[model samples]
Structure formats: C-alpha cells, structure tokens
Target: MGGKSSAPQVVLADDNSPTPSLPPSTSDDPTTSTASQQTTSTEPSAQLRPSDRTENLATDRTSNPSSSVQNENAAPVHTNQLQLPQGTQSSRRRRREASPANSREAQDRPSFDSLGPQGETTDEPLPKRRRRDHMMRLEGDNSNTNGGPRPFTNGSAADNLTSKSLNGLSKAVPAVNGSETINGHAKKTDAESSAYFGHDREEVSRLLIQALSDLGYSSSADALVQESGYDLESPTVAAFRNAVLQGEWADAELLLFGDRDGSEDEGTGKNNGQGLVLAEGAQKNDMRFWLRQQKFLELLEARDTGRALMVLRTELTPVYQNVHKLHFLSSLIMCPSTEELMIKAEWDGAHGQSRHILLSELSKCLSPSLMVPEHRLAVLLDQVKQSRIANCLYHNTEVSSSLYSDHRCDRENFPLEVAAELHQHTSEIWFIAFSHDGTRLVSCGAEGTALIWDMQTLQVIHTLSHTLPEHTQGVCFASWSPDDSMLITCSMDRYARLWDTETGQILRQLSRFEEPVSSCAWAPDGQSFVTGCLYKERNLCQWNLNGEMVYDWGRPHRIQAIALSNDGSLLVATDTENHLHVYNFTTRELEYEMDFKVRLTSVSFTKDSNYILISKIDGEIRLFSIENRKSIRTFAGQKPGKFVIRSVFGGADESFVISGSDDGYVFIWHKENGSIVEKLEGHRPGCCNSVSWNPKNPRMFATAGDDQRVRIWCNQTASAPVLHRRHRSTLSGPGPV
Candidate 1:
C-alpha cells in the first residue's frame, strides 16, 4: 500500500469495541494456516486498497461451501494488514493475476501481514514455545488466545523491533558497569604487585653491597653492611686491615702470624708473652719477611739507619733467600735521605701512606681458598669491566660512566684527535723511532733535520742536522740504540752518522756511500747496526760502534727495507727484485729466501721473532711465519706505497696490526682474524706515512703525515692523562716519501 490502511477489521477487542460472538463447533476440522501465504496475493486483492483486499479474501473463503466449516474455525484477522493505494493497485493486480496459485493461497490465509510490509522468510522452522512467547511480547496484549500466547502467523515488524531493543539494552547496560569494575580491579592489582616486590628487597640490598665493594668504595660498603645486617669481612681480617692502614707494622705482623712474640723467632729475644703461638706455614714465612722488609723501610724513612741495618741482618737476611730480593733490601741502607729512598722504591708518598698497598701484596702469598682477599670482589669486577671494554666491538666509551650499566667502549672516541703535536719539524717527517726505555723519541724528516724528544715533555731536547756533517740533503731514516743513549740518522746525502743524544754531538760517521742511505736498524745486542743503500750500490752493510763495516752483502737488486730480530742473530730484508731474504749474521749466509711477486715497501719482525710483517705495494700487509715459511694472515683497509707506509703490531698482547693509510686515515686490523677494527680519520690532504705505539703505554700512539704534523693520540680516560695543546690549524705541504 502507498500508505497504511485506515480501515478496521474484526479481530481482538479494543476497550471501546464490542465483543465478537464465537462460532458454533463444526463437523469438519480446519488445517493450520501457513505463514507463507501472507506474502501471496490474488489479482482482485491487489486491485483493492489494503482494507478492501482483506474483505475480499474473507468473502472468498466464506462463499466456498466446501471450506465454510474451516473458515468458521479460523482465528479472526487483525485490522493491521498490507495496504496499497488506488494508483498502485492496478499495476499490482496485473502481476498477481499472472500467478494464480499464489493468489489462491492468499485467499485461504488470515491477513497477519497487515502489521507491516511482508518481509522475505526462510524455509527453516521456528521452535513452538520461543516463537509463541516472542509473538506474545510483540502483540502489546498479554491475554492468551488458547492457554498461552498465540504463535506468530508470519514474521512481523513488531517482533524485529522488540528483538533489536532487547539486544541494544543488553549491550549498553553492561558496557557502562564493566568500565567502572575494570578500573577498580586495576587499582587492587597494583597494590598487590607492590606488596609482592617488597619480599625481594633483601636481594636488592645484596646487589648494592656487591656493587659498592667492586667500585672501591670502602667507606660506603662498610656503612651499607651495617645498615643491611650483612658482614663482608671477618673480625680477624678487619683487625688486620685496620692495623695495616694505621701503620702499626708490628701489630699487623702479630695478627698475620697469630704470635705474641714479634721478634723471638728471629732470635732478637723481644716478646710480649701473651702465649699466642705463631702460625707455621711456607706462606707465613713469606708474610713475616714482607713485614720485616716494610719495617726496615720505616726505619730508613725515620733515619734510624743503625736499627734498620740490624733488622735487615737479623730478620730480613734469613728470609730473603732470593738474590734479587736481598740486593734490593741491602740497597735501602745506602739512601742518604728518605726522599731518595721513596724515589728509588717508586713509593707513592712518605709517612707509610702506601702501607695498605704493601699489605695487599702480602695477602696474595696466602692461599686464596682459605683466606678472603682484602678486595677480591672489587678486583674481579674491575677486571671484568676492563675486559669487556677491550673486547667491545661497538658502543665503547672513553670512560666508564653511569650511562651504561655494563661498561662500554665508545668507538667514537677513537681515531681520536692528537692530544699534543710535535711542531719542530720544518718539513715532512719521514720516519719515527722510540727508544727501548720509552723515555725518548727521535724523528727525521726531509728538511735535513733530526730531532730527539723527551717522551715526558713532548718537547724537542736535541736536534741533529747537516751543520754537524750528518747529512747534506734531507735525513730520511732514524733508529735508537738499545741503551737509549745514542741515536743514528741516515740521509739522502749518502752518509749515516751516530750522535750522542745527551750533547746532540756526532759520535761517529760511517764511510760515505755511492748512493743515499735508504733505511737502517739497530741490533738488539747493541754492538752493531745495519744500513740499506738505494740506487747506486745494492748493498746491505753491517757496522760496529767504531764506524767500521763488519759485513757487507752486495745483492743484485736494490735493497729497500731491513729489520733485525730481537736476538740480533737474524736479519730480514726486502729488495726491488720482489724477494724477501733472511740472513744469519753469525753465520754470514742467507738462511732463507721467498719471492713475493709484488714490490715490498717495508718489513718488521714480531716480538717473538717467529713471524714477519711484510707491507707490499699491492695494498696489502701479510704476516709470514718464520717456522712454517707460509703466509699466516693478510690485513687490508690501507693502500700501501703511496709513501713508505710502516705497519706494526699493537693492542693487548699484540692482537692488532695498526698502519697508516694513503687516504689520510689510520687503519687497525685484528692480527689473528684480519678484520678491520678501526679506520681513524685525522690526517688531512695527504698520506700518513708512519705510526709508532709507545712501548710503555699501550693506549698511546703517534702518527706523522705529509702535512708536516706529528699527532699524538692518547686515551683521555687513561690513568695517566696526556698533556697537549689543541691545534685547529691545518698544514698544507707534500710529505717526505
């Protein structure tokens, strides 16, 4: 229907309507009306309005005499029925008449579809009780037709509306209540979680205690132990430590040995008679000796020379069986003043400030399994932190700070800028050498100048030049004597001269060569040295301290580089013929020879004298084993032969090979694995020709470049910080080759 039907139907009574009379019982029974018939319509029914259609269906049922009995028993139809306006009825009638069977079904059923538009229905059956109850709810009248609510004749609009309202109310009510309940539950959960963690407080306390001890915070550790009800040291150990700290040497010894007589065992006959027996063990003997030695030093510090000699003879002499120990103790008597004694012993200060250190050393003699060390936990944790820092591949820091829970090695600090620059060289520096004592450094350059630097001050203490007849052209190479008192420099001027480092005076001059001296090295024995000549005469000459040539090998190829073994028994040399030759100086014969195929720029020996480091012009550095005569490893990341780039072993236990790059960078590679570890970029505009690691300090190194600058790299967080002036100026020039 175009609009809802206004016509009324005879069905259930409204309050204002009169009650309908019941029909008399019939002989024939009516079949149950199928809900499916509601949607089917006849042509005559569609031509009329909804009220007219309802009346037509009822009249058709009553007129048929065969169905009259069934019609009388059927329930009365509701006024609510599918209604169509007059305009749509004609078109609908044409479609309905086309389907006669559907029209007949519509005439047979009551019109419950009057409630709303007839929606499509599925073939599935609905449960009797659920359907009946649901229909009763939608009817708005609770009165039952036959003992219970009537079953729905067809799916109704009221049923869908009631179901949706019920569902929406059910969802909305719980959602509001659930939010409030969840918030209250969360508060209770947090309270319970806090209580649970309270039980772990003791473990947290223990960890804090451990951290304090490891960091050498003794005062803090003691206070924490008292507050936390924990004991880290036994009473005897505490007493002994206190005694050592207070410089009560005799009391410390008594505590160590459990003896009342401090001197009776040594036959001095002095005793306190407290009846304490001395602990007897080999370790106790060493502890007793250490105590007596410390006491002797105290006497020396007090200028009680006569009593110190007595203690040395009566107590220390019997215990100090090692010759070195005896000599060290005996030398203390010769010191005329306490200041000199402190200096000689390398003590930190006077007045027994280092007594605790002495005690720490003495405790090491005792068996660790039976005795707790003074700072055992602290030392172990410190070691772990250091080891982690040394091996860290990333996130490394210069200092161990609170930023990292575990110590980190900050890689950014590396390839670090120079802490100090040696500026005396007026031209490009060619080579650098450090003395065996690590107290001095010598550098030679193309400016015909050779300068000696005091390692402590970073200042030039001496300079050797052409004015002294050492070189007429630029000095190209330099080496230090093993004793550190004499230095030798070779120049393009064709002569190699030795100079006294103290006076900067020429000690001796070797006979002038036909060609320039290219390279030189001092033998480990300090008796002789070797020089390699360039161009004119391809000879490797060995000379003694008297400026006399002891041995000379004239090879067919030009000698480029040479190195002497630590024992001075073997010499390894590289030549222009692409061959590496090893000779025994004692036997005066070539021990071995190997062909490299490429030009060799430099050669060096490992500290153990078992392997050789060979730098080649092919942009590679190879480690060759002397025993196996085979290549062990190859390090890359640096292009060789832009200048004579020298590479050497460094880092912990010589685990890294460090070299200068032609690209203005210093490259470090793991010696064992040959992996690039660092590419330090500080040298600018030209190649870094040489790098030298300080023999005394593993973390400090120096690099020189064609820029006429000598840069010193030091770890700022190291124990002994280096002194330097920051230079922001750049030098522009070509460096020496």
Candidate 2:
C-alpha cells in the first residue's frame, strides 16, 4: 500500500526554504542575502539543525539541491505546542521536554514529528474535532490502500513508517510511578476511574491501545501508545506477527521461540535478542504446534508435500503424540489437489485468513505480556454481554447485545403466551414434532391419525390417517426425516409406518414386531432409522426407508424412548426398567449405560451430541453428558408420574430445558443450573404430552396436551406476534399403559 508515491518528496522543499548548505556553512554564512530573502524567519539555528534521530537518515552528502534543501526544512516540529489528547503521556515527551524549541510564531507550521518521512512536511489538514490525536498514521496515497498486495521493503524508512514508529515506541519506555510525571497525565494512574479492575496504569493503557487497534482505530491506538508511553508488544514480536501473516514462518519462529541448544537451555528469554520467550512446558509445544500447523497447511496448499512431510516429522510430530490428528494431517497429502486437501482439512489456507484467527487460538495459551489476545476488548465486552444475558433470567431472543449500556432483555421478550391453537386431531395428541426445516408440524393423535400442519398458514395441510383398519387406534410418536419430506410414526397397534408428509400417504410400513413400536429416531442421512419396542424380545432394530430391517441389537430390552444425536454419532435409548443405553451409531456396540432409580419416559439429544436431555416418569428431567454417562443436572417439579411428559432442549444455544407437565403447564428451566425460569400456564386442565419447538423459529413453539389441543405459542410481547388463526379441541389423553 505504501509502495507508490503520488508525488516526489522534493516537491514540498521549495516552500519557505533556502539553498543547500551544511550545518557548518549555515553558521559561517550568517548573513547570506539569498537565505534571508527565501525565508520569513531569521533562525538558521532552528531551521537548518538536523533531527538527532534523522542523523542516521542520510550519512553521505548529496549534490541534489532539492533533497539537500528539503533536509534543512526537515526542522524539528515545535513539540511544546504539540497538544496531545487527554489521558495520554508521550513516550518521548519527557526526554524532549528539556530540549529547547523556537517561538510558535517563528515556526512555519505544525511538526509532522509524530509521523512523516524526514524532510517531508505533510500537508494533511489539522483536524478541527478529535477526541484523541494519534501520534502516527499509516499513510497510503490512494483509495486502494486496503486492497491489493504491497511488497514490504524492510530496508527503506520511507516505505510504511509503521515499523519505524513502533520501534521508537518500544525503545522509549516511559519512566515508572514515583516523582516522574508524563506529559500532564499522572503516572500513578493512566485512565481516570477504577476501570479494568484497577489494573497497572500501563496495562490498562496497553489494553485500550490494543482495543483501539482492534476497533480499526489504528491511528488512535498508535497515538495513545506513543503518547501514553504504553506499548502492546515488543517491536520484535510485532515484526514476528507481521512475518507470520505474510507467511514468513521461519522469521516468526526465530523471533518467538528462537533457536537454542539441543536441550533448549535455561537461557531462552529474548533469544537471538528478539521477542519474548512465550512459555515453558506444554504451552511451548502448543505454540510450536500452532505455528508449524499453519506452516504445514500452507505448504500443502502450495503443494510442497516434501517440505510438509519434513516439517510434519521434524516439527509437528515431536510436539503432538495424537496419532489420529497426525494421521489426518498426513492424509492431506493423499488429496488429489490443493483445493481438495483444504476441503478435507477444513482449512481456508493462508490466503483466506493466514490472519488473526491463529493469533486468537494461540492467545488462549499466552499470557498478556508479549502479545495481547486478538480482540481483547471484544472479549471483555462479550464477557459483559454474557453477564447481562445471564442476569436477565428470561433472556430468549438472539438479538445482539448493545455496547452503550448494560445489556438487558425485557421479560416481555420471552415466549410464554400462546399465539395460536390447532384442533385437527380427533383425540389427544400423543407426540408432536416440527419438521427438520420447520415448515410443517406433525402431531400424532391417539385416534390412529397424524396431521401435518403448514407453519405458514397455521392450518392442516395434510391428514395422515392409518390405512389399515386394525392399526387405526394408534399413531403415538412421530419423527421427521432429515429432508423433512417423509416421517415415521410409532403406532400403538404394533406397527411403525413411514409416510410421505407432503401427500399424507403411507410410504412404508414395518409390522414385523410382535409388540407396538414405542419410539423411533432417524439417521442424519435419512437412509435408515432405529426403532424400539417395549415388549419384543429383540426390541431395538435399524430399518431402511424401504421397510427392511438392516441390523438388530440382538439384546432384548424394553425400550420406551429412543433418540439419535443430530451428528449421527450416538444412539441413546431409555428402557422401562429405569436404564439408559448409549450406543455408537456406526457400531451396534453400547458405548455407555446408566441405571437410574426411576423409569425414563423420554430422551432428547443436544444438537452437539455431547449431551442429552432425559425426562423421567417421576416428574423430573435430567441433563446428561454422553461421555460422563451420568446425569449432570436434574430439573424437578413437573407432574409426570403416570403419563410420558416429553421435555426437549430449546431456547438460545439450547440453554433452556423445556418440558410438558401433567399440570398442563410448560416448564422452562435454565440448562446450566436447572432453575425454573418460567412456568407457562395456558393449556386446558389436563396433562401436556409433547412440546415441539420450531427449529426455524426461536420465538415460536407447539405443545400437545391431554385436553386434545395442539397450541402454538410465541413471544406474546412482540409487536403483532406471528399472525395466525386459533382452533381448539375437546378430548382427553390415553390411559396409562
């Protein structure tokens, strides 16, 4: 971005400047007529004196009158009149404060001392209104500053002054607390109030600096850091970061970890006289792994498999012993092309990011010393957001948290009131579920009927009644296919029927079981489904969509409620004997099992498949982790002693446990603590059977009860809510088995 110059630096040298003369020549010819005629002021002392820092700018004398004259006008900016914003102490302010300066009237213009190449007076207009002025700015001459690639000429000072500015900042560490005052701000406390937990003044300043940079206030961050004398990183680390982003891994590694003796030695700090020693122990290995992982992935992207293999063996492999991860990394080489390898590896490669994401990951293991975590301020703000969400008991909506004030969701935002009611079922609704895409709702009625209602119209679009007269008394539980085009229903008449949801016609029927199929769960691919019977000797079986049994569990168990994780990894089933079995979906092997004191009535898997929600026959709901194989949190107080009251995980991030109760109220509890947030009392006086939260609509849900009514609910306080018709039925639930 800084490569091209719109105009040469010598163009501005003619403004109020004299002919070329060395500093000695200026003193010798004190009364030159041309020097006197060219300038308004008569101070050869201030005008011709070269900057102490810029003495290194040009070591050799040049005959070009343009550059030599520009060098004389490269006078030091009047630092005394240089007003910095509040809460900032210039890093060089103390050192230069004792240094004298000429009168403001004698000086031609404000100094570009903060930023600007030597001998160049930036014509940037003085800002009229600015809260805080940054001392330096990364100047790009055109509109294409953010676009296109600009080669870094590391050797040149005129090419992108950022590295040079940051170097000045890092070297000039302001004096500590005591009698030393910085700029006019107190050295004891940088930011005014007891913010940031009343941390070290420099720490808070650095955080603000980092936050400003993260917020795209690069100039402001630079100003605050240079003026406040607080640096976010050593210049070496900054260069290292730049190198990593630019795909210079060797330089970054050299800067960060550095080369040491074979044992890695005791003296590792500031190795090669650059960057801090980030960590010791496993953290160091993790840092190495992250750096090398990026390097390996990028190498693969470049199709440099040979170097990748070398890095894999000599670098990554020694850090991590995970064979599976190594195998996966190794398998990327087998990919036919670079694009294919990235797809399989799920990496965006160096081009897409090669950015701050790695910094974010690496920051998790890093202390806030050498490198501040990526988006540190955003992380802090999110912490505030989470606190606001957590304290707001009825937090329901996925609306983004506000930054100006303490985020608070009004209780009115919660979906507690019923929006609409449906009466298509002839008897009490045994089970109800929203389609995978949430365009339709399927409610199975005890009268051997299943109805599919359009979510848009809030009306019955298809009526799914049993084809055989003998199986007409059932239709208890229903599960939707992954595509939502078909569904399988568990019938009390000892049959499981798959139906075309759109046509409301039976697609396939499984009547091989001697007992009624009580529960069903579909695979993620919808190619097969697992069904369970409460009494059959070989109760659990997986059946293809064509009605053929593909595999059987072989072990007979009285399965009551069954569920498969959305990831299609685990199959969880609860039996009537108060036992729950978790099996690997690929292998019919039981992964984990839990014996409980009460019979589990229903089970629901979290979208992540890491945890499951189980409803009990004892009016209790418990959340269990599959890996732990035990209940982590138990939510009690719902009346389900006789009937199966299904509870499912819903709400934002599935953070709430929602269940239907015999008391006819829908109970919602916080998943983290099992504390009741709301007890929705809207259903007619009878036991509520099932609740189906609209997968597509977080604000709306449907509940089926013994009152034979399927009521749709939404965030009542919403403006107009979702406009839909209401219908109710008069009936009761089936008797206990």
Best by TM-score: 2
Per-residue lDDT tens digits for candidate 1, residues 129-232, read 22222322222222222221121211111111011121122211111111211100111123322323544333344456657877888789777766544344
Residue runs of model 2 more than 4 Å from their true location after superposition: 1-200, 246-250, 258-282, 293-360, 418-421, 437-439, 455-458, 535-538, 587-589, 627-630, 652-655, 680-685, 714-724, 727-737
What residue pairs clash in candidate 1, if any at all? 1-83, 1-84, 80-114, 81-114, 82-114, 396-409, 396-410, 397-409, 397-410, 706-735
Give the Cα error of residue 362 in candidate 2, in Å.
3.2
Residue 60, model 1: Cα distance from true site in angstroms: 99
lDDT of 2 by residue, 178-248 (tens): 11221222222334323457454556677798888878899999888667555576444566667667877
Backbone clashes in each candidate structure, one number apiece? 10, 3
TM-score of 1: 0.44
TM-score of 2: 0.67
